[model samples]
Target: MARGHWLDPLARKVLQAMGELPPEPSARPTPAAPPEPPSWVVDVNRASASQWRQLPGCSEAMVDLLLRLQRGGVQFSQAEDLIQLLDLPPELAERWRPHLVIHWYGDAPPQPPAPPLDLNAAAPERLTAALLWPADRLQRLIQERRRRPFDNLADLQERLCLPPEVVEQLIGRVRFGERRPGPSLPPGC
Candidate 1:
């Protein structure tokens, strides 16, 4: 069978001698596979705007629409509530259903209140931050307040040189003497 007749046996002997023969069984038992991880769920009601946009098939525009609904005093009780409130497309709703979840906290994120700032008690910084008034106008208001607290809306308008429209806007948050300032503007105001 020519010179190659002994080569196969020689090779097998070499492998056997070198302890490289066949696939050797392990000395120790194999470890069991690690347990599978728990699946993730996104709570629609509690998630922030950015988090909402991170869901499967979510879009920024859709998130903006949801935010608008939220700001407009809409409360979503569940994924269905969000779908209905947003008037989501049927196909889109189906796509989102797999990932959407709702863990209802005690309540939904509160809508900002009308008259969210108190003219009489709010600091210059609050007026600047909340009212978004220019510093000069805020300074004028501060100057006027130094003399006495605002007696009423008209007094504020007169002293602060506020326009009628601006006064209308401020009417919600402004308060006179004993009344407590509310946290938000009135709905539909």
Candidate 2:
């Protein structure tokens, strides 16, 4: 009987000359890494505001924006599409893209052509059409907008003298981007 070499391949070969197990299968091919799951897949049309909030790196404000877009018949076909349409910050968008997916719905009804209204820019008619505000209030808003553009959601509220509760109610119902008569301008512009 003979002891076997555990370390040296040559020694193992020598042992094999006498009779021993074949040299360990040449370094096992490195096992391929497992495929990653599509963890970021989000059903844009179906996800609730809360669900949207659950996406990695998403804030409450981001969720609101997403829901508003969804309500406006803006269907997200891909992460890139959502990133471009939302005009998300490049770094933030890139960081979150891996976890996002625009889930498909089979035989879903066609989306409305109209997109959600931009709080900073929507026409009085579009505002009326999209929101349930009274004509008089909408008129005041349009007039106020002309005097000085809304600074942000807060500015819109302040300009309109809306209570905090009212603003809260309007959260997912409106967006604050692209001023009317100024497609390139948002709150600051």
Candidate 3:
């Protein structure tokens, strides 16, 4: 018998061994639906570790650090408060900022906005505000600058006293008021 002719009987025997075969055609192996994404809930003052972990793009380490900060009597008054904590990355802090809630303490007066620094004329406050460094770190940077002004962009990179990535970020955001005739001025000049 022809090879093609043998296929029909083989198919029949296989189907018969498996009990009654279907007369009509049927689709096989339906596709499964995609899983739903994790839901996010912003619980301002009382968010748990599990809740923090649910945030999109948050890592296990990041969530643990956030919970630790929360448990250490640190109340997040503003989204930017995360920057004050040393463990959290600036990028992750900024990303999760919108999800945080501010709980008003009793009789706390509305705080005024910090004055903007003149990157060209003013001190490290300009850089600190722009780069999100703590006060002590900012002071150290300012002290370093008082010794000598930065001669060029490379000098700024060398003496900025921040994480290299943060220095890069500051470099991007810094708006030089006017190009000094020669090179970039160092901090605190």
Candidate 4:
């Protein structure tokens, strides 16, 4: 056997007694297994822009887009849904997988369509046809509007001395708008 392969007499005796020899030590230490990522799970469905910004690779534009979509009643039910919504790269999505959590709170109720007629801006003839008001009442309404447009049903009712039943009926049929600017029409015009 070569001198390098030969073990010391005492060491060989110990190895023989132990039944095996330990492996030779290397010059460099063996590397340990990679550490797991820290848990920073965030519920994307309800996370604020700042929270979204806290993620490793999230961008300001992505946060803004998320907020806009949220405001428009969009809900993301999964990380994949968000990835698709923002068109995120697979690598970025994978990077975000451990930190992102999705929670779904059922879809928001639909909003009712706006009333077609604006009480503050409608013509007297239109008001007469829609509201079926007497000519005198319609004239009074126009005069009141000319002074200052009705802000809402309460304001309209108060200014015109309309009954509760009239205001109630106007609820879904009428809407008020900001007062129009410029010269007011002359009385009885």
What TM-score do all the candidates reach, one by one?
Answer: 0.33, 0.44, 0.31, 0.39
Ordered list by lDDT, greatest first: 4, 2, 1, 3
- Candidate 1: global Cα-lDDT? 0.58
lDDT of 4 by residue, 1-189 (tens): 464438786786587567586544442358998988756777876789888988877888788767654544445545655665455788888888888877767653223234448888888888998888878889889988878776545456656767544553554456676665655433332
Cα RMSD of all models vs. native, in order, equals 16.9, 10.3, 13.9, 16.8
Q: How many backbone clashes does candidate 4 have?
A: 0
Candidate order, TM-score descending: 2, 4, 1, 3
Which ranges in model 4 have alpha carbons more than 4 Å from their true place?
A: 1-37, 107-189
Assess the local accuracy of residue 146 in candidate 4 as a C-alpha lDDT between 0 and 100: 78
After superposing candidate 1, which stretches have Cα over 4 Å from the reference? 1-112, 179-189
In terms of TM-score, which candidate is strongest?
2
Candidate 3 residue lDDT tens string, 1-189? 553323476686577557665332332446898865434546544678777776657677666655543443334445543343323576766666666666744344233244423345565555765657777866665664455543323345445534434432332234334434544444342
Worst 10 residues of 2 by lDDT: 180-189
Predicted candidate 1 versus true structure: per-residue lDDT over 1-189, tens digit per residue: 563324477686677567676422443358999865436555664567877876666778767655544443334444654664345789988867776775644534323345445567787777788877887888878876665666555456656656544653443344554444434322221
2 or 4, which is superior by TM-score?
2
Steric collisions counted per model: 8, 3, 1, 0
The reply for model 3, stretches above 4 Å from the true place, is 1-39, 83-98, 105-189
For model 4 the TM-score comes to 0.39
Q: Model 3: clashing residue pairs? A: 150-186
Please report the candidate that would top lDDT against the real structure. Answer: 4
